[model samples]
Target: MGIELLDRTALVLFSGGQDSTTTLAWALDRYDHVETVGFDYGQRHAVELEVRSVVADGIRRSFPDWGDRLGEDHMVDLQVLGRISETSLTKGMAIAMADDGLPNTFVPGRNLIFLTFAAAVAYRRGIRHIVTGVCETDYSGYPDCRDDTIKAMQLALNLGMDTRFVLHTPLMWIDKAETWALAKLLGGDELVDVVRTQTHTCYEGDREHIHDWGHGCGACPACELRATGYRGYLARQQA
Candidate 1:
């Protein structure tokens, strides 16, 4: 089967998590020229940065065909963004509801900024497509994860930079289980195994307490959502 993509080159906003890793595979499958970019925004789960390094290396080693086509993987430092935001992901504060009913983990304009920086990077590299793993379903209530926000950001980017950059959200409408299905479809079972065992999604970044969903503390909302989705996907496969 041929990979369904309108563009031949892409840049994925990879974070070395389940969804972002899956998105990377999706890009690798379709785009002839693909690269990944990650952010270091002073998050509490700094281990994910290490995980990103390992996962990027693993992709190059395991999937040589895809890796050969892959471009330079970038890790941009945005600690100033974290310093200005009071989110739990960055500041390690309590997970309380904000005045707008969003979680304390909602870092305002983080995704927007990430996508904008990604657009600049892509424009410089002559890439027009930017793939992100943001989703609304089974998400952590980050407003920036919404499709509308992405569209707005895309338009803002194109207008601001005078470049026709297409923001691709492959997992925008899919839940966690469907995201796993996508990984299997794009990279096959080995890719599924890699994502299940290698990626980091825990808020605490506890690699010791491995679960069906991946490595997580099992107490945070991210772990709960991931584990539940993995169980659902497994059941679906069995049935």
Candidate 2:
């Protein structure tokens, strides 16, 4: 657990979703102080902040010793800066989440912007290690989530700030099944409870189906991925 030495401090890019919630648990174990950052880009499902606040609050309650390590309002008024090629997340376009191929849900430069800002935040705090829940294996054609992109960004951020920084993505190679497995490893069955109840992955900004793990729509691309991963995890357990 060489990575566990990161216990003193780290920053997390949280979106109150399965990936981010899993990242939070992972952060709690490894980092002595984990600071979570979430962005509000006026997304289609902006209700995520409500869920995010709940999750952060829970973290403070559960890890009272590490109280207030979570930071709020890492978000920007992205609506003004959100202009890009037609995207479901950037625009209110009713684009279907990609199923067979890359979906419109992929907002260009989103992860780039978020990570850069997160790095800036870490820099201000004199922290170099930053943890995020970005996954490439399970990624649905989001160009920003690639390993090469991450490395490049790391270089750019470090050079721009003239400081040492390590962008850590624990779920990069792992699929969602593995992510669920990791969450369970960190938080046990509580993983399911928090992921399903606290995380927000809905394109529709829903909370009605909070009990359905991270799956939002049965037909949407995001929902399909979550369902597939969850089922794969269950199958593994059964086997």
Candidate 3:
């Protein structure tokens, strides 16, 4: 199922990657005030937060018609949550198949914690909409990226906080290729270039190596998926 766009002030859960960058543009297109909230959960790809800042700045500059709707960017430190988790993302362990059939990179409840914290921050800023770039179709075996999980979290947040906040997932039903298409549609070809070069998705967080999709450690699962999707997108465009 697809999510409907919200026409209100929003808080984007910006991760400084292709997906989140696309969603930031999506939110900016629909909302008047689009603030961003990032997390420092001790993930191996912490550099993506820095990329988030650059991309956010680029968005404000590129989309001047949106005015100063790009509000403050808030970064939360959730290092304690990462310290207790043994996921490859936070711990930098080898990527292996978990006994439960999930990827080793699956950070348990990472999105749940991120959305909960983001909602708290958004509520403080009087925002009721939270936009996230999570995509179930392109996700790397992370259950938290699923739509049902997001709905459940949204309901819980509303009940707990007594606020009617809507969680926006622009990429929830789309794959990485479609996400690329969305970036183009929302912010034109320039936004696509920004997402391609500035975003970071490597589980190993290797920014030195350039690939077709972006900069990433080619061997990692994230890079492999991104490369495959970019290839697909190219083929479709050519056809």
| Per-model RMSD to reference | 4.0, 4.2, 3.7
| Overall local distance difference test of candidate 1 | 0.86
Question: Which of the two, 1 or 2, has more TM-score?
Answer: 1
What TM-score would every model get versus the actual structure? 0.94, 0.87, 0.94
What lDDT tens digits, residue by residue, belong to model 3 across residues 1-239? 12233447899998898888888888888888888899998988888877887877777677786547788889899999889999888885798889999998888888999999998887788887999988888877789999999999999998888878889898989998888888878877888888888888888889899976889989989888888888888887789
Model 1, 116-206: lDDT tens digits are 8898788777787899999998897898999899999988887888767789999998999888888878887888888989999887778
- Reference-based TM-score, model 1: 0.94
Give a tens-digit lDDT track for model 2, residues 1-239.
11122337888888888888888778777776677787877687787777887877766665565455554336545564456546787687786756646778877788998898898778766666888888789877888999999999999987887777888999999999898888778867766666866777767775666335553655556666787888888888789
Clashes of each: 0, 2, 0
Candidate whose lDDT is highest: 1
Q: How many backbone clashes does candidate 3 have?
A: 0
